[model samples]
Each structure stands twice: as structure tokens, then as C-alpha cells.
Target: MNTAQLKQEIIEYSKKIGIDKIGFTTADPFIEMKNRLIRQQELQYQSGFEEKDIEKRVNPALLLDEPRSIIAIALAYPSKMTNRTISKKGERRGIFCRASWGIDYHHILRDRLHLLEEFIKEKVPHAKCKSMVDTGELVDRAVAERAGIGWSGKNCSIITPEFGSYVYLGEMITTIPFEPDTPMEDRCGTCNKCVDACPTGALVQGGQLDSNRCIAFLTQTKGFLPDEFREKLGNRIYGCDSCQTACPVNKGMDFHFHEEMEPDPEIVKPLLRSLLQISNREFKEKFGPLSGSWRGKKPIQRNAIIALTHFKDETAVDELIQVMNSDSRPVIRGTAAWALGKIGGEAANLALEKAQQVEKDEEVLNEIDKGLSFFCKDEVGQ
Candidate 1:
């Protein structure tokens, strides 16, 4: 069994199964990535959703016994929604970034990896393999970068020459020793557009990211969004694509390679007001398949309130007032109160004043005061 022939077979099989790109690398410890991860830890820049054990993250040996090679796969997703939803004056909408536009990539990637693993086992009966998507211990970008799948972009995304940065990455560690692919060179020369376009300045520099300020991480947080990022959130209900959108290589890189990765106009860009009162069951039914829903509806609801304020959608004032007064979750209620303040008007002020009388939660009260301060500013202006 020629290893090179086997690698070619795997590559061909990957194409048949719809894996847009595939590459291989030695399962050696990622020395440079470990140092960067340490720096990220010292800087408090990690998103905290990653595997906590740094050793497992950098060393493939810790994950699998005598791992020989790692296979990295990429699937291109649509950058622009083909069937777009209209976000008009009265009908305001919130977005789930392009990454979350379609069926969750985790499921799709895992399925592809599983198929690849089965094919390898058929060829090599003694082969042992382990696969993971974004949530895996190994850094998907690092593996992809080493495996020649793509270069690590300034936006902290894997930017392939064929698909730009609009690709979902996953990897598999295998015992079969396969020839490694040449890693791509750093092609993002003198490009700082991704850093400039970050809404919260999350991209600290070319390849470094401060996840604390990243809207993608911030939106998944269960607590109330910080005051600084509220206005920057725009209409994004989950994740942010500013950095990717700003990349020169990603310009006009709209790929509809996978049907499952296509965005449903209504689901990804849903009406802002509808999310305020969505039931748990309804939220699950509507967004459970999307990766953004993994954090549950609380953050989505909180972000939706902020989005309403971003637009100053007067139509949502009634909905925000109702949420401020009636919602069970303090974070949601408090966010709604703050949104009412940001979207200041007589109805919003009246609602905040009314909430102060009966709202027992201390945090919600503080948010109510914040909301009232906007009216105070308006008064002083007058």
C-alpha cells in the first residue's frame, strides 16, 4: 500500500464527499502555536470556549497514541445571502453572521470527517483516527496552516486562496503516516483592513485577536453586554463578520459550494422584535440547527434588545418596555431597560420610571437609571 497513492485516494474521495479542500501535515507538537497561546493567556485574550488544557491543544501525541499525520479539511460557505431579507424602517432585523447562516458547521464537518475516517479504515484496517471541528482540543487554524489548507489570515480566520476566509475548518489525527503538504506562505502583506474594520477593535493586530473585545465572543456571553460594545454591535444577534468582510482577498468571494451552508434569509436575518418574546421551544425550533444557538436564546435576546436600540426603532419600544418589566432573566430585563434608555422617548421613559417602582432586581434598577440618564441628557440639551 503506497502512502502517496493512499493520500491521493483520500484527496479524491474528499472531493466526492464535498470537502472543498484537504491537506495533510505531520502530527508534531505546534511549538510556535504554544508560545502564542501562552501569550494569549497572559494577555487574557482567549474566548474561553476553547479546550482549557494547553498541552492537549499543542501536542497531538496527548490526544492520540503515536499519531503520524493530521488531515485538515475546509468547506466554503456563502459570504452573501442569495435570498436576502429586507431590513426596512418599520421591519428591523438582526443578523447571525455568515458563519452561523446555515446548518451548523460542527455537524457538517464532523460528518465529513467520519466519512473520511471510514474510507481510511477500509484501506488500512489497523488505522486509528480522531476528528474534531471548532470545539476540538487542537487549534483548527494552526493545523490548517501547517497542513497547507490555507494561511492564517489577519482576521484570525483561515484564508484559503480558493475560498478566501469564507471557509469552515476541521481536522483529523490519524495513525497512517501520510506525506505532508507544504504550508501556504503569509500572503496578507501590508493589509490592515481587518484590524481597521473590527467593530470593537478585537483584532489587536494582523494575526492577534483580543477575544475580550471580540463581538463574536461577546455576543455569546450570558450577562448584559458592556456599555462600550452596545452601539458597536449594530444589528448582529450572533457573531460578527466585519474583519472577514474587510479583507481584500475576501472581497466578492461569495461561494455557494454547499447547499447546507446556504443562509435562510428569514432565519439568519430575523425581525428584531420577534426575538424579544420568543419562547424557549420556539427559539430552539427556529435556531437550534444553527451554530449560534449553542449559547441558548438569552444572549440572542439581549443582543436583539441592543440591536433595537442601535436602530432606535420606535416600533420596538413597546416590546422593550414589556421585556424590561416582565422578563424573568435579569440580564435580558436589564438589557431591555438600557435599550429603552438608548432609544429614549416618552413611552420608554415612562416604562423605565414604572419599572423603578416595581423592579426588585438591583442590576435592573441600575440599568433603569442608565436608561433615565439619556432622558436627562436630552433635557439638558433642551
Candidate 2:
């Protein structure tokens, strides 16, 4: 079986199966990535969600036996959501990043990888292939970059010239010795727009992201947002797109190729107040399909409360008071207290003062004090 001919056939099949871009690379250990990841670890820059075993992350041969080549695939998602919910004076909304706009890309990309695997097996009866999406041991972006699917963008995203960092990446390690594609040259040149535009300066130095400061990573933490970023949280309920939106290559780069990738305006940019009281079952049913919901509802709810404060949504003050009084999680309750303080009405201040008397958690107590301080700061100005 000629791998050159087989590679061409696989490329054809990929397009038919809705894969936007595909690339191939040798299954060598990612030495540069190892060094970079080690530096990130040393600096405590990792998001803590990554595989702790760095060896497993960098070596393809360890993950898959006799891995001759890696196949990287990218599917472009819509950058702009159509039928967006217009937030009025009283009805404000929080947004999920574009990556979580539709059904989880993991499911979508895995399905594509599965089909590709089946095709390769049919052609090479004894071919061994292992497929993986984001959760796998492999770093999907590194594989994609090496496979020529895209260059690693300044924002730490795999940025394809065709897809403009708006692509979901997946990869498969196969025993077939397919010829590798050349890596794309760094086209970003001197453009520091993405780094300059980061809200928390998460993109600390161009491509290097201090994940601790990344609003995207911060949005997914199931705890109180740091005092400094609480004001920077804005209306993002899940993930941050500040760097992506600021990219000059991503300018006017919205694509609605797949139906599953389309955003339901009501879901992605949902009403900030409505999220405050979402039940466990309701949260699952509504947002379960999106990739961003993997952290469950606590983080989203926590961010929603902060978002209310970002908008100073007086309408959410009553709900914030209720959460401060009754939410089961201390994080939610504490975040609600902080939101109330930022919203600062007589009712909000009174609710915080009342909750401080009964709240027991030390962290929650501190947040309650912070809420009361916001009121104190406001009075000083008045």
C-alpha cells in the first residue's frame, strides 16, 4: 500500500466528512513543548486542568505503540452568533466564548476521528490508530502545529490561516508511515494586538499565557474570583475571547459551516439574572451539551454573580440577596454577597449586613466584608 496515495485518499475523505483542515506529522517526542511546559510549571503558569504527567503529554510513542505518524484535524466554528439576544437596560446577558457556542467540539471532533480511523483500517487491515480530543494525553495544539494545520498563535491558540484560531483541534496517532506536512511559518510577525488586548494581561508575553491570570481559565474556577479580576470578569460566564477577537487575522472570520457549531443566542449569551436560580437539573438540560459546562454549574453561577456586578444590574440584587442567604455552596453564597455589595442599593447593603451576622465560612465572611467595603467606598464618594 503506497502511503502517498493513501494520504491523498484520506485527505479527500476528510473533506467529505466535514473536516475543514487536516495535516500530518511524524510521531516524534515534542522536545520544544516539553521545555515550554516545564517553564510554565516552574512559573506556576499552568491552569491545573492539564495532565500532571508531563512525560505522557510530550511523547506520542508512549501514548500509542509504534506510532509512525500523527493526523491532526481542525473544524472551524462560527465566530459570530446569529440571532443574538439583545440586552436592554434592565435585561443584561453574560456570554460563553465562541468555542462553547454549540454542542461540545470533543463529541464533534471524535466522531470525525472515528470515521477516519475506520477508513484507514479498511485500507490497511492491520493499521493501529488511537484517537483523542482535548482531554487526551496529547496536546492537540502542538500536534496540530507540527502537522501544519496551523501556527501557534500569539494568544497560545493554534491559528490556521484559513480558520484564524477559530478551529477545534483533534488528533489521531496511527502506525501508518504517512509523509508529514511542513509547519506553517509564524505569520503574526510584529502584531502584538492580542497580547495588548488581554483584559488581565493573561497573555503575559506574546504566546506565553500565565493561565492563572487568563480570564478564560479564571471563568472556569469554582471559587471566588480574585478581588482584582472581579471587576475584569465583565459578562463572560465561560472562557474569554478577548485575545481571539483582537487578532487581525480573525477579523470578519465568522463561519457557520456546521449546524451543531451554531450558537443558540438564548443559551450562549444568556440572561445574567436567569442563571442565578438555575436548578441542577435545569442547568444540565440547558447547557449540558456545550463543552464549557464540563466544570458543572458552580463556576458559571459564580461568574454570573460577578457579571451582575460588572453590569451593576440592580435587577439581580434581589436574587443575589437570596443566593447569599440560601445557596448550598459557600462559593456561590460568597460571590452573591460580593455582587450585592457592588450593586449597592439600600436593599443590597441591608441584605449583606444581615448575612454577615449568620454566615459561618471564613471565606464567605471575608467576601461579606468586601461587599460591605464596596458600600463604604461608595458612601465616601457621595
Candidate 3:
């Protein structure tokens, strides 16, 4: 079979395997992507990965290590039943943004891509292919845009008419070249909803994101979250989706019927009271199957405490006190103290006093004192 026929067969097979969109492009866009990465690094927006590693991330040659074409696939992850709006009632909300509300897309997309790769190898006999679901060196979004799968929205996500920016991307690098798809035109004309909706100003400009200010990055980050970022985190115990939620194109997408993508009921909008009690073993058991669990429980638990603090729901005081005593992680204990302060009353004051007696870390002790002072002010006034 000629390369043209093989490409058609592959595209057909991709749709059959459940990928919503598929496109092919030469591994050349990495050149421009590399320059973009350099600019991002210079702006101090690149985090998690080292700036030196930007070359590897942007260089398609490094992705294949040999000449090849890229097969970019996008999976739509919209939800129909879920409301994107922040609840006015202040009920402990389950805030899984449209994209992350289900089974990990990385797993789903990678499995399907592997099937596509195997099919290609069977047809071509000598075809060499590498499949990646957000796990490789290639700029999957850039390749998707170049291949006409979708346009890059101002939110820095690929936007499709059917899925908006609520789609996950995967790529297959192959030695067998195919006719490339034409790139799409940008459609985000005069709309700044995503930028304006961002609570932390993570979107520096159209199609640009500062990871340092991004709540999604902050929630997944290792170590202590800075005080400023912590306060801005609000009730987001995991990834932030304010930008995608505000995108106009995401309207009317069906999220309820996507059973494969439905979040575990317990995880969909975890109760802050229950979250503060998660043991390390429980954390692993609950989140082991989740893509977000890669960072471990510390960050999630810390964020949970922060959320509890933000909610300032007095009912959670006893639970926060329990965490203060039982939780060993300094960050958790510290955050619990902070929560207690936010919920300050007689119960909170007593809990902070008890925590201060047992707390050994200076930071934790200071947090306890800070929490106590909230109620102490009332006592002085009385």
C-alpha cells in the first residue's frame, strides 16, 4: 500500500477506536515551539520541568530521534449534567472541571493510541511508531493545531467546535509519512473570558500561561504553597478549571452521558470534612488510579485544609482539630491551624490551644497562635 492509502486506513482506524479528532503533520513545528519555550522560561513562567529540558520538550527530533511524522489525536471530554458555575449556596461543591471529571484521559488516550500504533505496524510491516499521551517530548497541542485538529484558544488549550478546549491530546510519532492536514484558523476573536475568569492571573496574555500563578500548577506542586497563592487558592483542592469553564465555545457540551469520563462519586467533589482525615494509605488507595495522584497525598491534603479554611464552615472545626492532632505532615497541621483560625469560636480556640501544647514545629506553633488570636480578640472585646 502507498503511504497515502496507509494514512487513510490509519485515520479510519483512529475514529473506530473512539478518538474524536485525528490529524497528521511533519515533526517540524517543534522549531517554533522551542523558541516559545525559551521565551516562557525567560519570563520565569516555566516550572516543574527545568528550563534546560525545554529543548527536549520542543524538539520533535528528540521525540523520534529520527525523521518521522506526527499523528495528533484529541479526545472530547465534555460533561452534560455538570454545572460549571460556582454554587451560590456555598454547599461543599464537587468542582471537577469538565476535563478532569472522569477516568484519567492519559490512560484512555494512550491505550487507544497504542491500538492505532499496532494496527499501523501490522499494515506496514516495517513501520516504527512511538505513542505518547502527554508523556513524550513533543508539543502535542502545537502538533494538533498544525495538523488542523483544532485551533489553540486564548486559554492555551486546543479548541474544537465539538469539544471546545475540554479535550485531551495524544500523539503518535511514526517513520511512515502521510499527507499532512491543513492548519486551522484561530477563532478566539475579541474574547478574553478565560483570562478574565482566571482568579490568579495565570493567563499572562492570549495563548500564554504563567505556571507560577496557575492554580492548577500550585495545587499539584511539591513542598509548601506560598501564603499569597494559598489564600488565592479558594476551594480548589485539585486542578483549577475557571478558564475552561468561562470559554464561550464550551457551552451545551454533554457531560452526563460520558460514563467513561465520570469522576468517582467520592472524588467528584470530595467533602472537606472527609478529606482532612485521609491517611497516606487511604490517599494511595483512593487516588492510585487517578492521573492527579502522581504528586502524592501531601499536596492534596494540604489543599483540602486550605479549602476547609476558605469555606470557613464551622461544622468542620472538630474535623480540623482532629487533623491538627493526628496529621504528621507539618503542612497539613499548619493548614489545619489556619483553618481553625478561619472558623474561630470557642471550639476553634480550644483546639488551637491543644494543638499548641503538642506542636513541636515552630511554624505549626505560630499557626496555632495565629488561630487563637482570632477568638482572643472577641474575648478582649467582651
Estimate the TM-score of every prediction: 0.99, 0.99, 0.91
Candidate 2 has its poorest 10 consecutive residues by lDDT at 81-90
Find the candidate with the highest lDDT and give its number: 1
lDDT of 1 by residue, 1-382 (tens): 7999999999999999999999999999999999999999999999889899999999999999999999999999999988788999979999999999789999999999999999999999999999999899999999999999989988899999999999999999999899999999999999899999998888889999999999999999999788999999999999999998889999889999888988899999999999999999999999999999999999999999899988999998988888888889999999999988988889999999989999999998999999999999999999
Q: Model 1: runs farther than 4 Å from truth?
A: none
lDDT tens digits, residue span 40-157, model 2 = 9999999999999999898998988899999999999999877867987689999999999999999999999999999999999999999999999989989999999989999999
| Cα shift from native, residue 187, model 2 (Å) | 0.4
TM-score of model 2 (CA atoms): 0.99
The true-versus-predicted C-alpha distance at residue 70 of model 1, in Å, is 0.4
How displaced is residue 372 in candidate 2, in Å?
1.0
Candidate 2: lDDT over CA atoms? Answer: 0.93
Better of 1 and 3 by lDDT: 1
TM-score winner between 2 and 3, please give it.
Answer: 2
**Against the true structure, what is every candidate's RMSD?**
0.7, 0.9, 2.8
Worst 10-residue lDDT window, candidate 1: 318-327
Q: Model 3 — which ten-residue stretch has the worst lDDT?
A: 81-90
